[model samples]
Target: MQEDSPLTEATSDSRGASLLTSREPSPSDHSGRGTSRRSKITRKSHRKSRAGCVNCKSRRIKCDEGKPSCANCKRRQVRCEYPANPATSAAASGLVDPREPGDLPISEIELTYHWATTTCHSFSAWPAGVARVQALTEEVAMKNQHVLHLIFAFTALHLAVCRPKRKEHYTTTADYHYERALALVTPEIASLSPDNCDAVLQSVQMICFVSWARGPQAGEYLAFGKHGRSDWLVMFRGIRTTLASLSRDHFSKTHGPNTRGKGRLLPPSDGPFEYEKQLMELKEHIEFVSEPADRDDNVNSVEVLQEMYSNRYGGKDGEYHVAFGWLYRMSEDFLDRLQRCDPLPLIIYAHFVVLMHDLEKFWYMKGWTHHVMSGIYEALPIEHKAYISWPMARVGWIAP
Candidate 1:
């Protein structure tokens, strides 16, 4: 489980470095759930393929390619079947042949490889003490947080790269990072923060949204597996419940006003004033444009205002559409930066964008009982397709 052990492998190191071991106990250990953890494990089943189940691949252990019966499956005693359909089987092959239409460019793939190797090096550089701490806690040390951050951020970077390029499958390494991040944000970590309420809220919203995007009912963006179908809806509803808790009073006294007459200041409770202003500006912009102008020169405040309330209160009939015009644009900007320059913060921002995008989608879909994304999706121009694609691509069982 050491950082040097590699992600594809799934074996315990005697050195006491276990990155991601199953501490929750395999499903067989408990009979309450319908499925066991062994069945839930994501593994490839092609006999000739070397990149097998993450556990076997990492340990360099032999994989039987047995559906419900691989070596790992037998060891863990779980089902190990491969995808049933041709399209899915091809995807499970995990071979990125450049000849494939949607395969990443050689340069991009090389960059990805380089980044991954660099991340591994960084992970390895941690003091043995930190590794020991992480092993005991089953979580990476603060030194390892940067690696996780980069992993989350890279999703937006890939989105930006995918914007101009229309490939059969527009998903990227970022999605995988996001999924892992969600998996990492356990209840243990969340309970550690009591003062950082907003941070916790934001994190919860982000995970919920990401889960929804990759859940069932994701339509065209269903890149993950079938589990997304049930998960998407469940997460969508959960997002509403979480966000609904955010009544006007939910704003911190510092962010909102003590009295009605006093102006509400947003920066203190959130991150910064500039971000709040930028968010407000985007909200205003979305309100302004969501209408039909009688004259191009005239400002149709009435139409715009109506659209605003309608969107906020849920379209015409309690149907909510998350306002993510700003979130979408910001993600696109970060992505563009990554493609044109170093892919660090830009990648990180992409994860931020994905998290926000999920929040917006969850607010509207499960909360409102309508396809709120349609309005948001339709509101944008063709130029914004890539921004939409980032989240849309997550609309599968288990978005990569």
Candidate 2:
């Protein structure tokens, strides 16, 4: 048999939809379960007409009205999304009008164009190597269909955040590309090769960006909630695992298996830190508010924060993933307390949210800091609320 390219396009599926969370495959799950549900995607039959998918009309482009994907979107290198009950919606909404297509302020082509130039840089936190990562991502994406689709997907998501009135349209567009890429890429994750390693690793990050940029999940904030670690963390943990699977000749060496579990001091910084004082105050309040049994656990949690907060990342503008180092190193017991909405952990997590706010300038991190901070404030008791004054005031979080 001749060799098959990894760039094979995904066929439209008639099978029932599944949640993205449920579809994420664990490394130990060699069953290839993620691809099983997608097995029923039969060939799609297109109904040609003047009208096309929702994205075409939204972008004011001339769509050829193909099912699953249109000629215009495919040619422009952007996501394709057909309306549900496409014929019915097209007929009812009168989406098609007889006129020449016009240019847009931010066209779909522009969105795709930004991916290599702008979106890819967000993956690397270090300023010195952003261009290198972006170049690698684009180079890999060109030969890999899965990586290309996710690149476009993330760009569409960024565009959605930029335009709130058209948020739903762009978000749906992003999901369409993301779902397709994920379906095709899931099985290949376990059996990575030299050729596909970088592409697959890049796709994993695209998955994280798509998940996080969608805004806060209802119950999940910063990977802690009633159900332990959120799905986001579940997916993100793969970055290191995948790196371990590969040689790491080029990928940034930041995410290697973190054995920094506990009892290690961070690289010391020279100066009086405000966060150190905040931690001291937090420890003081834990004495006042915690029950005898709970007090010890709460103190353990703060001590973990003390280690995380004791240093600065490259002096002020923190590294990209610096904020999340605490979450990765936190004990399972403390995570349980967070899931239970324990006041002390919530307050401590709020301080971490301040670090998360350091990345607030990024489009994905823009509103997340305030959102997580608000969740903490709401979860905290009135007495403990005072401890988060700095975080609350820092993020300008207003109570509902």
Candidate 3:
């Protein structure tokens, strides 16, 4: 509830009496009347204090006594404090720090709540609401929690797109939540091997998104206590290790073929082995393309990359089409350059070049890529020739 102002009421009365007081008063009397009116107005104006959440009030150096906590406290994930008699308590406890006039007073409780509510509160709230609906077992409750954790982790992943600096804190929270989520999901996985299914898929996706969104964090987390990009590389390397483990137990049940009661299926002799080899090829190619390069390759040049991007593969018909279908759009030459370029440096440089409009320097150093590719196009097979040239011809119009 808002407090009424004593000064406002007193001011109205003073205004009403102004005409009477002005009627031929003695000079001394007039001065005394003026002083009295001023003092009364000051006291009325100063009466009753403003209250806010401890966090907000401390930040504002005002009393906060509203909804257990103030808006700022809630937003910042800080603790909120509500003293019994806020005004009296503030004065007695010297809550107001004179030295740092700008400092806000936020209680620990308010901060914690602020962080929870602002960040993962919505996600965490889901498990609680879900647990009560169907008499959930501890295992089931944990699974629900896992879903909530995935939700929170992805939420953090999305946030990383905009708030890159907060990646570390968000990552920490996400992984801790992930472990709990994994505990819930693992039993289901163990029981139903390959059919480990949706919950597992989501958890894996969350891990992938988190790693992709904040690559640096993946590096740090996987390293135990070690530092650097090798750990980051492990993000992919580790995928293989995981697959190796999965293959040992669940490969046959989940995949085609039943080797039950037969001889053991060795790595290279099995179909799954071949599939894994193909997967590894793709993984290796990705790692290679994304690796750092000291100089610009043909793929890195804007004109050549743009040509590669504009080219599309046709289906069975001999129509105008580019290969790899629509899904592989980024798989084009320009993207290849990005894939080949050291993502860390290239992304930063791209941002700078974009911000500064350094197209002149960009083209000057890389423009000849088109000329080089023109010769390579001539050597292509007849079918490939048409696809390459048409896209190349249109490159002038499609300025990068």
Candidate 4:
């Protein structure tokens, strides 16, 4: 190679200087000035953040330190909690006293007991298995985060619905615990273990209750609107899928020895139950009525009304399928009318509430039937009162 070019020589010298600076300071270079300058530059380049909300800190992002909520969390719509300052923050927020029992907060314990006694009994629809909810509540709920959060969420929702004066406070508390349980349990939904299976199933059930509790008119109507109906269906489907997974796993474990070495086994199919047949009929009726040319408003309306009662007491599985099924099967125009609290739709909905009474085995539906019926009664006009007489009689409401 020819004599090194000035540019190449300069590059090599700079690389050597970079290498020297990266290494620990050597005694030969220790005027202390070079080391101090390098350290200062390094510190400036890799400064550690000393203040920010916990969410921003955990995410390793810069925070604008907004009060109540930081900019980062506001953008993401996540809870922004700051690190507790022993001096000022704790006192301002009315932090729980350290002397209070730490095992379970007194308020939480009270809510759990309330759920066990009142809420548990209300949702247990099956007569023979009613005690199971109470057993699970007492045995597993206290120690399990998923179940505990569900209990708190349910209790708060119940209070919110039953005690309107304190609805906001109870709703806020319910949302907090619901979010916590959802965050913890969502990841494990796909890979449920035997240890967590029961909690997951129970959480699904409680989540269903939460959905119902927050439903249209505070769990009164079938929540037929687009926003409420789709969300409720999603949660209902989640419960169905989770239950199916649990059943499949249990079957696999039970038959594993006999089926050893068998390639991945498929789940055994149980044919549709009786209620499913009625559901199919209802769907067929809806399809017929929805046809452009074949649609007869008078005939279609009559057919739908009849089907509502045909599946009113939803075969053996309980009334939820039929109760919600009717709401789901209705045409968009009908649903819109229902959402607007129209008299005819309210009358129809009140009949569905009659079906709900038979589902009282479910705690969430205990007072719902009466509450919805009362709302219909209040909203129905005098001229339209005659139209709802049959439904009123069915729900045991004597018209004034």
User: For this target, which candidate reaches the highest lDDT against the unseen true structure?
Assistant: 2
The candidate with the higher lDDT, 1 or 2, is 2
Name the runs in model 3 displaced over 4 angstroms.
1-75, 78-144, 160-202, 215-235, 244-400
Per-model TM values vs. the true structure: 0.27, 0.62, 0.26, 0.47
Candidate 1 Cα lDDT to native: 0.34
**Full-model lDDT for every candidate:** 0.34, 0.62, 0.33, 0.53
How many residue pairs collide in each prediction?
25, 1, 33, 6
Residues 31-124 of candidate 3 have per-residue lDDT tens digits of 1111224643543222112434434444565432334444554555433444344344454444532212333333212222332334322221
Q: What range of 10 consecutive residues in model 1 has the weakest lDDT sum?
A: 22-31
Q: Residue 302: error of model 2 in Å?
A: 3.3
The prediction achieving the highest TM-score against the true structure is 2
Candidate 3 has a TM-score of 0.26
Candidate 2 per-residue lDDT, tens place, 112-204, comes to: 556644675675554345544555555556556677667768888887877777776677768777877987789779778765676777788
Over 1-400, each residue of candidate 4 has an lDDT whose tens digit, in order, gives: 1123111122244323111111111111011122224643554333233567666787788866665556776666544555655533444444533222332233454565466446655643343233544554433454456666776788887877677886776776688678878887787676787667666766776787776666445433443432344455456556556655655545334222122122222222122234344434544544554445324532354465456545443232332334454544556566556666665556556645655665554545556566667667776787766655655665576655
The per-residue C-alpha lDDT of model 4 at residue 251 equals: 34
For residue 303, model 1's alpha carbon misses the true position, in angstroms, by 16
Instruction: Arrange candidates, best lDDT first.
Output: 2, 4, 1, 3
